[model samples]
Target: MELTYLQTFREIVKWGSYTRAAEQLGYAQSSVTTQIQRLEASYGAVLFERYGRTMRLTMAGEALLPYASEMLRLHAESKEVVSKQSAGALTIGTIETLAAFFLPPYLQAYRRDYPEMKVNLQPGNEPFIIEAVKEGTMDVGLILDPPLADPELHTVVVRKEELVIAAHPDHRLGGLAAAQVRDLAGESLILTEEGCTYRAMLLRALKEEGVEHQLSYEFGNLEAIKQCVVYGLGVALLPRIVVEEELRNGRLKAVPFSHPSCEFYTQLIYSRKKWMSAAFRDFIALMRGGRGEASKMHE
Candidate 1:
């Protein structure tokens, strides 16, 4: 009956655990249970079932998810439609690399104008960011990945970013003009965590080429991987933007590795059905990096 209940219900569906949903929504577990109970009473159906250790949506819950999603979307739309456009809050989901290397300048510029705007930068994997954007929880999703296609969200290719192999300046591969897949045979590779898009592409290409690689170290942090590479630990595949400073300063060298599958881009994503507020429009326009748009945001 209450919009809060539906919001909580959808959060439960997203996380698949009462505790996790509660934590994410900033509600106590008991409060989450109570909201679900009230929602079930309103609908006269059991919404979830215990499945092993986690929760699974019941048939009734499954049927209600789309409706709940729609309700939330419309609720958000109405707020945007009626509220004064001051860019009150903008939530962005992105990966660590982009969060650290790519977005700071843009955030600084945007905040300079909309100093009162509440901006939440939620760092996450590509898939999670996409889903958050689709669900209307995140107002925008900024990611560095290959082209994405999804009916529920609008995708924009901001720019193509070269993927590079980063290595210590003194490493053996540092002298290569361009390192081919075969050139990396038997080399120790430091890589990002499993959910990384470029990491998957790199591994797959190596596998297809039947190039044997030594996985020396795995890390979730870009700086950690770069630091490891600087230690002569191993070469790491990362966005050129990420290693630009290190390469410029002689702390790291670009190994000149090129792979078609590893090609990626900086992209923007937003829900297709959600309303875009004036501030939201300005933010997107600003990200488009057009002279006209950049000028508008400052004005």
Candidate 2:
């Protein structure tokens, strides 16, 4: 009848060994064995059958799996809800691009506005961040444009950029004001690994144009790619915001082209069912107004 006993039964069946389940649960093996015994006695049915080192779930245990899992899930969800209602720590998810450039200033201004708010930022690409917010693991997410819409999530446009080709200072097309798509033919290029929305878009464009190039290197970190470019490795196509500092410092050059410039937009996304605190409202309002007003000054 005790929830802990049900939880232990589920864990024992899940792991298939009492010792392994004990290690996972941080309990002694004897303690784990006793817990299961108690559960079986209370339920008046054998829950597991031991075969050598492994424990197989009996019919009674198999029948109880779904209900036990749901009970734990509901308990966890209830705890999370209560915690959020009491202490207002907002967890925001974001992608590396936005986390690097956009978040710092906004976060600084936000902290000044609401000093009491505890804000946690979780960084991931569009898919990961969207799932976090959709599942209530994150309060909000600043992400690249996703391919599909989630009815549970509401998205507001944050900022947009025109993607440009970039090359090291020493590359032949480096100093040029702009280069045609064909100019990059057969050149060694740097790109991120797959699952990146922008990289996928760039690949699609390249295939459509029949441009031949060598993807000589791939990097998981943006900073490493920028450093590689500074060392005169190869060219890359990236959002301007990501390389603004390198561009300003003369370490890299943006190669404009007659080809269609890839347009990327950042979206402020959150679940429609989420309860926005005072801090959340202020942060959203600041992003919507601040990004545009700040850009006009650059023009």
Clash tally for model 1: 0
Across 146-237, the per-residue lDDT of candidate 2 in tens digits comes to: 32356877777766766677788778896677776678788888997677787887777778889998898898788988887778788877
- What local lDDT does model 2 show for residue 261? 39
lDDT for each candidate structure: 0.86, 0.75
Query: What residue runs in model 1 are displaced by over 4 Å at the alpha carbon?
Result: 23-28, 291-299
Each model's TM-score? Answer: 0.90, 0.69
Look at candidate 1 and tell me the lDDT of residue 287: 86
lDDT of 1 by residue, 209-259 (tens): 999989999999888999999999999888888999998899999966678
Instruction: Please give the RMSD to the true structure for each candidate, in Å.
Output: 3.4, 6.9
TM-score attained by model 1: 0.90
Clashing pairs in 1: none
The lowest-lDDT stretch of 10 consecutive residues in candidate 1 is 290-299
